[model samples]
Target: MFEDIIGKMRGDFDIKPMEVMNLQPLVLAYIGDAVYETYIRTMLVVNKKTNVNTLHKMSVNYVKAKAQSDIVRRIMDKLNPDEQDVVRRGRNAKSVTVPKHAEITDYRYSTGFEALIGYLYLINQTDRLLEILRLSVEA
Candidate 1:
């Protein structure tokens, strides 16, 4: 599904994956959070077509730090060496803000997950990104 969208959108802009590699993990995560939110919101709208409030509530189950942490745990071993490197950088990088209500470990894992997502999004690797996103929620 996402593949078709990407095929059409690819010509819309050009990108450099190497440039994204130079960005800070937190900067990657910033874009990643937005990418993830849009993905979840799109899934909700396409799958259920419910009211906005209900969709938002349902999205909470998937977007929370704990959930993200667990999903990243599930997918970590499946990542390739390069992807693992990205996750490692994101996991170990210090952040200025701590999660107000989430465990530190979970927050770190979520950041790693978001970093990967942001990296993929910036590089216009939509197919690979969607593949990872599917792995994220498969269970």
Candidate 2:
């Protein structure tokens, strides 16, 4: 289902899937941020319907930079070497600016976490992606 959606999106845009290894770390983080937020929102909505404002506030607990950084810290030891390398590449990637609300360290680490999520998604590793996402929620 995930692959189908990604493929359809690519087809719609007439864009070929880029080689994951050759893609910039920030690019991965970009998609990862969206995917992570979507997952959290979906999880929340599926559990129970709520006011949009309430849902947004609840989702923030999981999707915020500090929360993501904490989640990554808890699960880092469980990642394979390749996943760790992806995180490192993402964390070290230079960006033009940081969000005003996040600490620098939290922002960097959250970027790394998002990159790992994006890497797994791009590679079509659904099981591992879901595993990590589940762990993130638990964390």
Candidate 3:
């Protein structure tokens, strides 16, 4: 499913399995954060038809550490083995500082969620990535 999407995006995009396999967890999380946020923002605009401020508020509500943790708990059971492993790696990753108002658990889960997104994107699995994200938010 993902390969088809990538193929349609442009002729230049190629999915090299070895390249994706070499990515570090932190690098995945870094890319995933941006991908996830962009998806959230796009979804909000398309579904809610709201103003910039309203979109910002809604996006924040969904992307925050606590919300992401809740999402992870709800969807973890549905994830594949590899996805679960990715989440575990992200959860176990060490961060220098915790969010001001969020719980450590929430932050960890959020990081895991971002890592999953990053992993999917890195492998050019855009369809699966979008599907997982949609399922997560809708749940």
lDDT of each: 0.84, 0.84, 0.81
Per-model TM-score, in order, reads 0.90, 0.87, 0.85
- Give the per-residue lDDT of model 3 (tens digit) for 14-60: 75757765766767788888877877877788789868998899899
**TM-score between model 1 and native:** 0.90
Error of 3 at 27 (Å): 1.6
Worst 10 residues of 1 by lDDT: 2-11
Candidate 2: regions farther than 4 A off:
1-18
lDDT of 2 by residue, 26-117 (tens): 98899889878877888899886989999999999998889998988899999999999889998899989978999999999999999998
Task: Write the number of the candidate with greater TM-score, choosing between 2 and 3.
Answer: 2
Give Cα distance to truth, residue 19, candidate 2, Å: 1.3
Give the distance in Å from residue 34's predicted Cα in candidate 1 to where it truly belongs. Answer: 1.1
Clashing pairs in 1: none
Choose the strongest candidate by TM-score: 1
Off by over 4 Å in 3: 1-15
